[model samples]
Target: MLGELEMVKAVLSGSRRTVVLTGAGISVESGVPTFRGRDGSWKNYRPEDLARPDAFEARPELVWEFYNWRRESLRESEPNAAHLALAEMERKKNNFLLITQNVDGLHCRAGSRKIMEMHGSLWQIKCTKCTHAREDFSPLPPMPECPVCGHLLRPGVVWFGEPLIPGVLRVAIDEINKSDVFLAVETSSLAQPAASFYQLAKDHGAVTVEINREPTPISGFMDFALHGKASDILPELMAGLSE
Candidate 1:
């Protein structure tokens, strides 16, 4: 087992590019319920039935209801110390990129620049017909058509059956391949393409680090396994790096 302190020290002092992959665990610190625990919706309801594009198309109202509830939940939460630590890392170094699976905008709010949101964002909405993008914070009535083109409005997220945004995926892949250090933070290590990102980073000769409370699928493959909550561990690890 690599010493957590020594691993972080090496990350701070390393010369190659650094890439960060964040997941639901980081948002858990901000009071957002993860999708895998006792209260996780995935255990009770099938995400494919709810998160698929077909579901949204057949019942936009239902889809919006879930998303709106999520939006409200996120509104009450604040960015935690772990998010701030990443921002601190950005300030201290020039070769870092933060890639997140969360729809919450906490990372951006915490001032982490160079972030690539793999799943898209809740703050953004778009017209299904005209590509009109809007960022609205309030609940909306059933949007029947695009304001500009009369097309049905939809959430700006990658649905269960949809492909990821090509531009964002391209950037993430490029960064992972270019990095000399890659950190997987608070992720389940089971999510599809996202889990694969860590392997890509490793294949590129980057040192891979996993920060989670428990062992995950890729635990054995990681160079360092830092066991703790990101909010508690990240701040402590980064405390001395800003100097």
Candidate 2:
């Protein structure tokens, strides 16, 4: 196992330009459960079933209810140490790009400036019927109908059957392709395109590194795997980089 101290040293002394891909594991430190875990409160429901356009079409209210709960929960949580560490790294490292599968805005909350929210964000709501969208600071439930179109507003997240936002994905891919180092932070390799992003980074000749508690399907595929909580590991690494 690479010690956190060494990881930071490696990052600071590494080749130019670092690209990061973060996922649910990173947010788990912030008290957000993996929504699909067997013991999870939201376990019975498929995110696909609740997050899809079809679901919104059939039962917009239910979709709103589900997301409302998520929004409320998110409102109560704060960014954790790993989030702050990444944000701090962004400040020190001029060449950094952050791509996250997490819909929570914790990365931004932690002060990371250059971020590509791959799955979209909970802070934004958009109408399915129209191009209408807005950023709301209120913790109001997701039910507020679009004043313009009177259509129900939904969270601006990518559902199971939806393609990633082209602009965001293109930018993330461009950074990944140009990166000298790729960090896959606290992610399960089981997820779809999120999992495939590591492969894309590898194909571009970036050294791929993973930080996770357990071995994932991509464990062997990485140039290195560091087993530990990202909160503990990343801060330690960031401290080393500042030395």
Candidate 3:
């Protein structure tokens, strides 16, 4: 049997269209907190509590505090090797798409142009009472307000029990259905929609690959399961592509 690297490389070499799905694991190496593991708690509250609509509704200031802390933590973090490798892959591939669940903008900072942020970005702010949303990286006040309308502004993230921005999910599925190769990189494969994306790609005749530090629920189903840090594995895979 071919080794994992060889198998993935072979599949990628022959594919015309490729899609990559990523999650929080991809950004861990860059010092961003996973917010699901050991670092998941803040002020005795679990991430689930602060990440829900009810929590924000009950205490908008508290929710903003959590998010503000997260933003400050990620402010100085830089994209790691895995992020750079994927960006390089995008530059080389004629047809490539990146679908990510991470709210952080590391992938964009790494130079990836064709991207779908399934989870809204932390940098984006939306007015609660109007259709006003814009990307801003500047420091925000304790409680931000919309400039367009004097309404409260909230982070443009898809909180728990919230639906994704319209058309994002549809477009992602459409791309996955037509891809020739699909890679799940640094994702836990536990979240809905994204958890099933690899299966969808496989059903549609795409070669499926998983790159993660640990075996996820869908690892056994992939055509090739590469286990390691994406920062390490992706650069090696990129090297194979160049050869």
Candidate 4:
């Protein structure tokens, strides 16, 4: 039997089109807390409480407070080895796509050109009363207003109960369908849509791989399950592709 690393290398060696799906675990090494973890709370409120459209509608100031804190916290966080390795993978592959659930913009900072931020981004803001939206990394006030409409501005993230940014799902599914190899990295495999991507790739005849710190619900489904820190495993995997 081939070793796990050898098996992964063999799969990548034959792959032409690859799609990668990532979640919060990939960013945890960069000091970002997982949404369901103990550190996800602030001022006696959970992330679920603050990251909702209703919460922003009722107390915009409080919502902004939480997001602003998150933004400031992430401002200094740099992409780890895993992120850089993925960027290198993108550069090497002719057809590569990175779909991430994280909103921190670390993938972009790491130089991954083909990316889909399924959950939206912390650096983007939109007007509540108009169609104006733009990226702004500057520190925001308690109640930032739209430059175009003066209406209250909100973080560009897909708040709970809100639909994903239009067309992101369609494009992601299209890529998954065309993938020759699918890698789920640092994901818990609990969230919807993304949780099912591995199965979709399998159905489409793609090799499925999972790289995570712990076993998840879908670990048994992957063709190869590599359990470890993504910052360590990803660089090693990418290095094997060159040999």
lDDT of each: 0.83, 0.83, 0.91, 0.92
TM-score of each: 0.93, 0.93, 0.97, 0.97
So what's the TM-score on candidate 4?
A: 0.97
Residue 110 error, candidate 1, Å: 0.9
Q: Please report how far candidate 3 places residue 41 from its true position, in Å.
A: 1.4
TM-score of 2: 0.93
Clash numbers, per candidate: 2, 0, 0, 0
lDDT of 2 by residue, 1-243 (tens): 556448545755565888888988898878887765664556467666788888888888888888888888888789999999999888877898888899889999999998999888988888868999887768765478887888777888888788988787678778888998888888887777677888898898888888898888998988888888999888877865742
Q: For residues 1-243, what per-residue lDDT tens digits would candidate 3 score against the true structure?
A: 238788788778777999999999999989998877987689999888898889888999999999898888889999999999999989878889999999999999999999999989999989999999999898899899989988889999999899999999999999999999999999988899899999899899999999999998998999889998999888887885842
Clashing pairs in 1: 146-150, 146-151
Lowest lDDT 10-mer window, candidate 4? Answer: 1-10
lDDT, candidate 2, equals: 0.83
Q: CA RMSD for every model? A: 2.0, 1.9, 1.5, 1.4
What is the per-residue lDDT of model 4 for residues 134-184, given as tens digits with 9 covering 90 to 100?
999888999999888899999999988989899999999999999999999
Ten-residue region with minimum lDDT total, candidate 1: 40-49
Question: Per-residue CA lDDT of candidate 1, range 126-161, in tens?
Answer: 988776898878766655357898767887888887
The whole-model C-alpha lDDT of candidate 3 against the native structure comes to 0.91
In candidate 2, position 77 carries an lDDT of 87
